[model samples]
Target: MNNGAVIFAANVDRVARFYEVILTMSPVYVEPGLRVIASDRTELVIHGVPPQVLAPAASGAAPEPREDTAIKPFFVVGSLAKARDMAPLLGGFVFPPEREFTSRRFRACNACDPEGNVVQFRELLVSAI
Candidate 1:
């Protein structure tokens, strides 16, 4: 089975666009308050949250990251360099390379999405030792 995940947000369009840049996932389905974005090997769903429930945190300005959540969404990315470059333009922030950690096969960095939801990005270590 394909592993997929959902992100519920009050600013679905902005968040979807942010993911499109960082994750390189294109929207296959778009509706009033829902969007499904997919790359060749992975799919992610962004569902709309009730605006009254959680007011959006930011617009073009960088949001104060909300990292107090229990579950943090992670994405395997092509390059942290690319993500680092692209994230802020989309209103999100990926911590700099200097703050990364490496596991057996990947180097990872923590980030926050456009709405300040904590997320992570990982890039494969080409020469894993």
Candidate 2:
């Protein structure tokens, strides 16, 4: 089955640039409030969300943002180090990469776009023969 994910961004263009650099792929589609970037047949859609929709109510009667409601998209990268280095340059923050027992050949890192959406990147380790 084909896999895809959508991320809401305050600035669609900015987030699109960030993913373009990390994925090494230009956006295949772009519009006023939307951008779609694809790599290896998988698509990542960045949608611009209006400030009013994301802002607290004028009456100060809004619930705080919840971690459980966040959308985290995981990406497989050719080089974690390169992606990590490029993240900050494109207005994104890259956490240090770590190897997990569940991911034998992958070193993963969590990164956030300027809009504060978490995106995970994983690098496949070369096998020693």
Candidate 3:
């Protein structure tokens, strides 16, 4: 089975764009209110926030980060160094290299998308040997 996540955003395009720039994935589908980006093992569905769910302050220009939530999706990337540099330009933030930690097979960091949805990012540390 292909593992995936569905993220809701005030601006679906912007959120989807952030993931596109950071992960090694391209959009499989796109529309004003929804987007689907996929890789070999992961897929992300970016959907527009429903009006009932949108906060009055959650404007499309700058969204409040929903940091207090419990769920945080993780993505495997090609390089944390590259993500760090690029995230800011795209209205997102990736934790600094100092915050990184290494697992048996990957180096990982925390990150947040343009709408302030918290997530984690990891890159391969070594191949199985």
- Per-residue CA lDDT of model 2 for 39-129, tens digit only, reads 7668878888898865322222222223355466788878878987887777776766553223687778776665556667887888788
Q: What is the C-alpha lDDT of each candidate?
A: 0.87, 0.71, 0.83
lDDT of 3 by residue, 12-40 (tens): 87788899888868899887789999888
TM-scores for every predicted model: 0.92, 0.78, 0.84
How many clashing residue pairs, candidate 1?
0
Where model 3 places Cα greater than 4 Å from the true spot, the runs are: 55-65, 127-129
* 41 Cα displacement, candidate 2 (Å): 2.3
Q: Which is the better candidate, 2 or 3, if ranked by TM-score?
A: 3
What lDDT is obtained when candidate 1 is compared to the true structure? 0.87
lDDT at position 80, candidate 2:
76
Model 3 has an lDDT value of 0.83
TM-score of 3: 0.84
Which prediction has more favorable lDDT, 1 or 3? 1
Q: Which residue pairs clash within candidate 2?
A: none
